[model samples]
Target: MAIPRLRPLLLVAVLLLRAFASLPTQAAARGGLDPSPGIADRKHGSSSRSLLQDQPEITEEMVRGYMSNFELESAIQDFGRRCANISRTYSIGKSVNGSPLWAIEISDKPGQREAEPAFKFIGNVHGDEPVGREVLMQLAYWLCDNYLKDPLAALIVENTHLHILPSMNPDGFALRRRGNANNVDLNRDFPDQFFPNNDDIKHRQPETRAIMNWIKQEHFTASASLHGGALVANYPWDGSRDTRKQYYGCPDDKTFRYMASLYSQSHYNMSLSKEFEGGITNGALWYPIYGGMQDWNYIHGGCFELTLEISDVKWPKASELLVIWKQNKMSMLNLVASLVKTGVHGRIFAADTGRPIPGSLMVKGIDSKINASGSFGDYHRILAPGQSYEVVASMEGYRPKRTRVMLGREATNLDFILDPDGAVRRTKPLRNDCGCSCNDNSNTGKPFLLREAYLWLYLLALFFLLALYLLFRRRMALRLAAHRHPPPKRPVAV
Candidate 1:
């Protein structure tokens, strides 16, 4: 009898098992093992990965190994050498203990800071959160190395300039403490409702002084402070007890959410969305913390800011360095993507007053989205545009102004004057077929809430994989059938 066909089937099964072994246990728990419907495990096993458990564990030896073994300076220098039209700048500032604070500015378009939206990425904001420093170095290197190879990296560098400060508090990092050399928490030093002015608290620290000056002079579009010790991406305006919390985000909730969502999607956590359920907060990941850099950036600098608590490790280990890099490397890219791609970039004004509209102004249309023209009647949206947009302008007492504009053409611009007459008791919100979470809640019937881009990408990838598998299976079957059935060798003899 011919050899059994079971051998080939067994070989295919082994190859599949090896492929799945590389995926983390958590992915298996979440039903991600099956790349396709035929291959997925039917029975459930407790194999899910915990968001909190994914980060590397820290220890004294791990810290020492990272410091002594890894030549960070060399890694950064090598990265800088790989890209064209990219240069690095070092901003030397003093730490609380008079130590040198090394900051790097990575840009493809030199001296074009004024033209592009400046973005600042600061790491090691808290001494215990040392992982930020590693991730940023990796980011700097990857960006430079991949600029020519990756279109996205090239586009980001060409359109937006990045200022990456790998270590904001060198002294604190060196000391391995949460506070600066003066033993004060740098995060708490920001001027807030609780702490006003540089007077009593006196924000005289060199790190703060240098960055504050840079932020004011450059007019950065957005910024993120990189820290570890937590797994969630925390956002600003934390002092508000309810919705009216004064210290919470600076008069623009829509802008904040647009940027925050970018960070959430690039990471592996969903708890980032549950702010009211204790998953999100201001001070905490998903919660707003008062006296934070994010609040200061919005209130003082007029920039959107986000805090990235990179990893769950208290003091991350050197071995976990690559893991952190994988988790965080895409966030800055996503940030750049949001700045370059999304948002409604315009100003709202009153029709009668000819003054910029102040208070809540909603811009909508067929897209089923709403862009809030903040207190200054200035709304810059990174939102999706569609065929037509219906805009409504409203203030506490001012009558609402309503109009429609088609946005399918070039950039859409609309200015309105509100009459003394009050409009119909506020119209319903906008809706769109696009899976944009900003203002449009359309497609709720679909049940699944995946992003439009993600859904499309998923479908494309699934189709490609299915085709490859079918081709391989067909080839194997043909080979097996040929072996099982003897060729018509006897025909010649007949």
Candidate 2:
């Protein structure tokens, strides 16, 4: 009687265990589970500190000078109202403590999507580094104030969609800690290329998930996250496969270097840094960190991102915020302007349909690929200035087109119209015409057939699983009834 009662429960437990056992482990996934507490301060000679060390306590004195969460929210809302013509305010998501993660989008057409490339500036990734949040607000207002009067400002406003999220980890900001409300470091919360376990979306923190979703929706061409504690422009790859502290360069190393140099050279004194050559360093070389946001942005979001450490002191006095903003103002403006002033912008279309085809763009010798927009089939490829590149546009069922062009200081516009593979095949005669004598037909049709077969197989398996679950429940109910009311043993007439 006891055995029957425990059987169903035991089976259910076994199934659940099996299901969870299939989940990827941290070691198997190749990502670190915990945040790199000291990695942010590695350049400041604090790499030897323990990961569990208590964060610097924030006192009433510290809170006295900085803007509270309420004040920052008010400032953002006020900016939206004051710059209504050029900006739109929206919440990306909420932080762990339910603080709305607000963003200010600045463009001539603030809410609408255009054929132009989009750029994002995220600040205050860590709660204690509030300098970026303040500086970003200043950057927004300055652009609004000087759009028509300043050529660089006017160019950025008219040509690009600039999205600024002044604070990513607002809960951390309110708590005066490096991590969010749950004590998760938002910077190390992203999925890492070296560590696959971090790729589990369900386990990611709310702030990290919000950023991931935002990047997917925005289709940003390039972005930067502002930080404190150092004065260097850092670019990916942020970590190494062997977990060693060394230089690791991604496919777009040259382009990233160019972007980083643009910011450092434009700054008042960043280029003069004695530690980092030209005030720029590869992220891994500076200090290796797994699940960092910069590398993930480049690998997954298709947005080239630079981690800009703008100040030497983290949590600098609020009075010095304005001066810090001034020091980095030109660097900020020039970085955004580089999107429109440089790069190769173009669209892809089908020659026969005369309609846009969502294709991909690739450069010769560069392993990375840039995808075109689905709606307009437009693409923006950022490259170092004064170079020649072979750009290729490709899509399924269409012939790939390749072209060579010289990119100067100004952006080049290139378009591609691809001919259908079948159309090209029609021009040539086959040796035999049994309607199966074509290589192109076999190449395309097999994939479609395989896809359809897989769809049916998935549906069938789902139905079978549902039926098995129902049968198990029915058997458990019948067994419970037998246990509750024992049948008379009168049938023992052997």
Candidate 3:
């Protein structure tokens, strides 16, 4: 009995010793992932001190030249008035402090919806990160000042619908904090893909709710949000499924890597960063954070988003803001231009009626699928260049159409006309989202199926009613004959 007890203790001791021995190896195998406050002032690393309070405290003097909430609103109004022809300013929603979350729309036809790819630039996600807000205003001004004069500006304005929201959290900006007036971190407030513990959308903050609703309404092709305290473009899969700090990538990992590389290389010195390789890092590989906006946008919004840290310090001197804008100008312009300059864009249509079909799209190996707009049936897909991909367009009542194309540096146009598969036709109604029915012919599969089912039901009901009437008349006639002629004899059997 004593030997058996000793044997169990010995086994437990050996297991403990092995676990202790493997600890250093696991940390060391991570290579140069060691993060500390001294490496950089930015709060981006695995170091506890870096994560806690790496950023210095903001002073009123430091933020002297920055625009106040009132000043920013005035600047937006000024831009709209100055460039009313190609730009329209509207409020997406109101913030916690009742500040209007203003957005600028820059396009040839500002308010009209065309078969064009849409891109949005959201700035000042954290109140303390004010660099984005100022830089975005400068971007709006630049586009307005150089629309027809500059080739790049005209390409962006004529091709893509660029929406810019200069300040996402005015309340936080006023409070000089990371969180909003409610003291909630907006970056960590989005619905998490890995953790569904607090995934209730209704309970989210108002600022977050506005962004969610905006994404649902718009068919954005791709977007990027601005943040400070680092100089790297962080791409999707921000959190690992097992909650481990490792390089976990999404299905569109290759395309995301390409996009991140593009932005970094376009920047002045981002590509030459000593900390990040090629000045681009996977979100989870850098430092995993749950409920991040980057992962949510890619997973749910059908929009490719990147978290761009354009500065080394969170709260730099206000004078450096302009210099920072100049550094990131080309990167911003190139990103917006890439929406139309590169990618696969086309419309899906029905073979029979030649009408637009609101179909979903898929690439051969990618796991994600994007939807086309119901009105124009236009879809924009971003893929890595210099590659051949089989793009599939699928709808419920139509046979999917696939085409293989070798994509190049320039955008490719490949329209698909799918034949209606009557064998698999469903009763889904055809939506006329253009506010007016343009076709008088009621020959769509949806209406035809409904009418066919109704006709069968009507015929069946008529047959049953006729059979019941005949039976009633025959019984009435038998009663009448019985009444006319009296019964002579009746035999009772016991």
Per-residue lDDT tens digits for candidate 2, residues 368-456, read 99898887778888999899887788898887766667778877776665667756322221111112111222234211122233346
| For model 1, the run of ten residues with the poorest summed lDDT | 25-34
lDDT of 3 by residue, 284-353 (tens): 7776777778788888878999889998888789989989999999999998888877778877777556
Considering lDDT, which of the candidate structures 2 and 3 is the better prediction for this target?
Answer: 2
Task: List, residue by residue over 304-324, the lDDT tens digit for candidate 1.
Answer: 777776776667667888877
- TM-score, cand. 3 vs. native: 0.76
Q: How far is candidate 3 from the true structure (C-alpha RMSD, Å)?
A: 21.2
Superposition error at 486 for model 3 (Å): 78
Candidate 2 residue 190 Cα shift, in angstroms, is 0.6
Clashing pairs in 3: none
Model 2: clashing residue pairs?
Answer: 29-196, 29-197, 30-195, 31-195
Residue ranges of candidate 1 with Cα displaced over 4 Å: 1-59, 67-84, 200-203, 241-250, 270-289, 345-494
